[model samples]
Target: MTYDIAIVGAGIAGASLAAAIGARARVLLIEGEDAPGYHATGRSAAFWSETYGGPDIQPLTTASRAALQAGGFLQPLGSLHIGRPRDAAAIDAFLAEFADTPVRLERVDPAAIVPGLRPEWTLGVSEPSCAYIDVATLHAAHLATARRAGAVLATRAPFHAATRAADRWTIETGAGIFQARVLVDAGGAWGDVVARAAGVDPIGIRAYRRTVVQLRTDPPAPAGLPHVAHIAGRFYFKPEPGGRLWLSPHDEAPTDPCDAAPEEIDVATAIDRFEHVVDWRAAAVERRWAGLRSFAPDRRPVYGFDARVPGFFWCAGQGGFGIQTAPAAASLAASLLLGEDVAVPVDPARYAPGRFGR
Candidate 1:
């Protein structure tokens, strides 16, 4: 049978888009893994910071707040952008960059960097409005909404190939042959691979591996501590349960698409970075994992139709902001899929696939 829209790769991008468009279209969410979000969405930092994606992404991040907060998926946990004396200029640049946005960031003095921060971080910026996102809950809720609206979700249905004819896409996958009026390439790390299989040229979408580790601190991580990141963009850490802290070396190594695993060197680098920012001892590493953060050449998400391939939608290249900006991303994508205008004022052309040229 044919569907109005068939979304490939049911991660946050696919799942959220499915939910958003299900009400007005016949939606089919196809996932290669046995479950949705087995990749990046499942291994997220689980935090929602407006400034996480830089200035270009703040609009989407800001637009998603209302929907994310509707279900109480956001937990209040402010953030600290700590930096050294040499980093003062970088801090000033960051402030100037987002000065017009709604995100609240204030100057943090050396004395204000307390609550366990090391002395080396002499200058900083603090955002009191940031919070931790309940990713598991958000993913589940979106999938459920899609199902309730009559969207079909197929797991373990790895997409193989596709051919377009007479405005219909005949797709082959592990499940079976299916047809769709519009094909959405939300394949995450394999977005370009999927586009190529669907007879579209690759748009230079690349995937990079990012590593994170959980460390046990000697003084024990306090529950009241805010999430912290280096102003120069080297590392970030946040409090975890059982006196542990979630830290990352913020390493973004170029890598091929696959099930990502953390390297020992990356973990060691993370611990070493953490030690420099805090006087507390890192007792031991409890857990470590890595995930792919896919991105376009310009580092912005691509969320429109393929200019060369009719009926093919490009909804990939979410980078690290996929979970944080899910609501807005999906809404914008759904609007374009349905040939409607977006609720937000931001132009969709900024993320259009046409920019790459066919």
Candidate 2:
């Protein structure tokens, strides 16, 4: 059976695209893992903050809010961007930059911040629109939608190779042979690798490792401690159930495609940064996990088809913003694939793979 589309990497990117593509075409969603989203999507920071990805990506994030809430994928949890006196100028610039955007930032007085925050954190802003994302729920929903729409989802099916001939692609995988007219490289960290395997030129996409550590705090982590993060990107922390605090040092060290594991230094650095931000002492690291956030050289997401490779679509390089932007990102990608107007308001050209000289 020949499918209209064969998408690699059944993470959020692929699943969401499959869902968006709907019953319009015969779609094949493939994942090498035993289950989908074993990488970035499953290990996401799992928050929807309009300020998370800067101005270029805010449009996608904002466009996804309605669908996220309507689908029961959002939990009310405000975000806090705390700044030190030294960060005054940076904080001011951030507020000014998003003044007119959908993200609403209210200046926070230092005295009102969480009790344990250090005195140096004198300036802060509260973006009340921010919310915790129910990532697993959302990912499952997208996969379910795709399945209900007749998209074939094959897991534990590692892609072996692909060849294009006579206007169709013959794909070899662990499961079996499949033929598709078009292929979507939603391969996450291995996006470039997938492209190369398909006889398509690589687009220079790279993956960076992000580490998250769950800490057992001395004072017992507060349940209502808004998603607090340093404006300058030094660190971020949020409350987890079980009185633990999820913390990251904001590390973005470049890494090759692999099942990522947290480094000792990364974990230590996170705890140290957390100590500096608040007076609460970390008693022990309850657990730690790492995921790779892939990106193009310019850091914006890369979408659209390869200009040089016919029937090849690119839906990679979403970085940490993958799950949060899935709704709009998938809509935009599906539109490009099907030759329709993008449901999202942003211009698609900026994210096109051709920008890399394809």
Candidate 3:
């Protein structure tokens, strides 16, 4: 069947774009897994801090607040950054950079760090506006909205080949053959692979492995505790729903695109980092997993059409901000495909794929 647009990968990026464009065009949303969000989108830390991304991405975060609030997917979980006296300079720089954003960060004394924070952390900052996102709920909501708007969603439908003729493109996939006038590559870590298969030049996209572990803690966490990150983001810990603590070393080791598994060494490093920074001991590790965060050579998300391929579009290289920046990113993609002007507050030039050529 022919579609107006065929979106590869049904994660946050693809799903959001599908939902946005479904009303305007026939969208075919395909996923490799049995279900959507089985990869990085399912394993995110679920934060909505505006200070998380670089200058190029901050405007998107700012513009997405209304949608997030209207959808009821955000909760004020708050975030705190703690560091030793030696790291004060780094902390100062962070404060100065985010001073004008919606995120309200305040410097606090060591004692004011979370109630049980280790005394070793003498300098701290708290961002009251930072919040936790309900990722699964948000993803489900978008998928439902897209399906209701007449978009076809197919799982376990990995694209195998693509060929373009005139203004149309034909794609062969595990599910079946499909045709579309436009193609969106939102395949997360497999973005480069998909582009190459579609006869487009790979855009130097790289994936990095990030590991997270859930641990059962003794005495549980004190009430009102906020998500805490060590200086340089070497490690981070947040309260989980079941009185558990989710921790990560914030490691970004370059990795090939594949199903990632947590390395023992990475888990051990996370444990050590947590132990050094927190007063409470992590009693037992209950579960562990890893996900791949893809980025371009410039560390910014690449969006818009492929310079060499007329009907092919790019919406990859989101890195860790895929979930946080979904609203604006999807809107931008839809705008580009529909030949409409960019409506989101983000500058199109910063995220355009053509930036790599310069």
Instruction: Report the C-alpha lDDT of model 2 over 85-183, residue by residue, as the tens digit.
Output: 889898999999898887888998754858777887888899898899999999999999999999999988999889999999999989989999999
Q: Per-residue error at 218 for model 1, in Å?
A: 0.7
* Model 3: worst 10 consecutive residues (lDDT sum): 110-119
Q: Give the whole-model CA lDDT for all candidates, comma-separated.
A: 0.91, 0.91, 0.87
Ranked by lDDT, top first? 2, 1, 3
**Full-model lDDT, candidate 3:** 0.87
Clashing residue pairs in candidate 1 (N, C-alpha, C atoms within 3 angstroms): none
Comparing 2 and 3 on TM-score, the stronger one: 2
Off by over 4 Å in 1: none
Error of 1 at 187 (Å): 0.5
Per-model TM-score, in order, reads 0.98, 0.98, 0.97
Predicted candidate 3 versus true structure: per-residue lDDT over 1-358, tens digit per residue = 7999999999999999998886899999979899999999999988887777656677777788789989998988888888998998999899888777666778877467466667778888887777889999999998999999999988888889899997898998999898999999999999999999999999999999999999887657666678888767799888888788889999899999988999999999998898887667889999999999999988889889988889999999999998888988899989988999889877788889888773
